[model samples]
Target: MATPRIDLTAAAMLLGLAAVWGGSFVFAEIALRELGPMTITLHRVGWAAPLLFVLVRLKRLALPRGWRIWGSYLVMGALNNAIPFTLIFWGQTALEGGLASILNATTAVFGAVVAGLLLRDEPLLPRKLIGAALGVLGVAVVVGADALGTLSLRNLAQLAVLAAALSYALASVWARVRLGDQPPLVNAFGMIAGSTVLMIPAALWSDGLPDLGLAPVTWAALAGLSLLSTVLAYLLYFAILRRAGAANLTLVTLLIPPFAIFLGWLVLGEALPASAWIGFAVIALGLLVTDGRAARALAARYFLHTVTKE
Candidate 1:
């Protein structure tokens, strides 16, 4: 069977997914002004879950009733949502949202490695190892070798972002293994619901019950974080996954950092160091390498497609 290529619509959705996911960092940053990291994390899944539940219901997808399935969703929730979201949100407390997104770009590289080790179908390719090394190098460049010397909050925050990437990678493997048979919308709802249940107590215990009174801007950020970044993003995510295959979806990982950096710069007046841009480029290169594509060929094909369409 031939591999499916992403057409215009899938590409657009893929871009949209990256934009919203990238904006997640900005939203978290905005909320962090008044909210604790745990509370922001909780707000994300807590608000998104019910929305997804409504979506699942409107779609009329049968919710899996098995505890075993819910058990998997719970694990998925921890790996995918609760842990990663909290880590990334907390990371943003110290790290620039742009840099966090750049470091988060390593998710695809780590995902390739983790998936290779865990899943039989995805064996360790030489390119992947090189790509993984490049990814590590990129991170080192971004965080600086000084981070290795001390356990400072900034260093820890950088580490936290990388940890979130690994969590996301594991979540993909778990979803493929455990929730592959469930409807995509159902799995989305299930995992978000599971994570919300887990996060409520975690947030309350860590941050106390959240204060409802907030600035209008913070509330807007929370709404955007919950609705656009989580709910709408997932819908776009699964739709693109179904249409373009999992491999093509990895392209979104590369697309996220730019939007994040742009939003950070344009809205928050944040500026990144040249090293950060260099690191992002390196990480992007690593991802393309891991995809086993010659950059030249990929560009050529894209240009050819554009010309043909024109």
Candidate 2:
């Protein structure tokens, strides 16, 4: 069976999700200036957990009581939050936010292959690879082709971000297979709670105690990271996962940088360069290739029109 594709609703949610998540790199960059990777990771999942809890209460979603489900939640938390968050935070210390985001776009390709292997219903490799390749090329172009070629001792940091991308890919597939029966809200809560539990101790042991007298800018960044990026992002993420399937959901990574550039242009009145607009076009083309619908429509229109005229 072909893998499920994202609908318009899912696509809009994904664009919004990508926009918020794009800022996470900036937020983590700011927050990491004063905080350890562990503490930053902790703060993200820790603070967001309660906000999700409040939302859950308002929605009257029942919390899962079973240990088995919680266990799966723990794994989800590790893959989706704890591991990736820590790695990316650390990786950003040595890499530019754009470069890190570029590296993270590998999630689309990784998700495509991983879901194909693990999810029986997802499409085989052939259909997804064309788009995955172009999505990656688009990311590299968006950030400038030279970004990926920058080699320093921080090659480890690049590896770290790539690992985080892989974790994200795995988390997408795992959520589909393991937590498919649970409500998205419950799964969001349980996963955040599980990460919070794991993070608190790890942070304390690694970072000791966070300095309470943080700069206001740092505080603002932390709040943005937790409230917008984590809280809202989790909700949108699981919604996309449920609606679009794992492979399509991961394409959000490819969309992130474009939205980031667009937001800068729109909100800050920053001018977009030729490359930025070109990159966005390329990214859209890649997404179209992945969806496979636009290509069919184009072929039917132009090819058939030409044949009829001939």
On lDDT, the leading prediction is 1
lDDT per residue (tens digit) for residues 76-156 in model 1: 999999999999999998999999999999999989999999999999989899999999999989988777888999998
Kindly report which residue pairs in candidate 1 clash with one another. none
Residue-level lDDT of model 2, residues 1-310, one tens digit each, is: 6567788999899998998898888788788879999999999998999899999999998897878999999999999999999999999888666556666766665576778778899875565777677766665565565657786646778778878988998998999899989888888899999999999999999999878899999999899899999888878887888788865775776678766555544543545457645655565565567667667788899999999999
Model 1 alpha-carbon miss at residue 31, Å: 0.2
Q: Estimate the TM-score for candidate 1.
A: 0.93
The CA lDDT of each predicted structure is 0.92, 0.80
Which 10-residue window in model 2 sums to the lowest lDDT? 263-272
Off by over 4 Å in 2: 1-15, 132-151, 236-251, 261-288, 302-310
Models 1 onward score TM values of 0.93, 0.80
Clashes of each: 0, 0
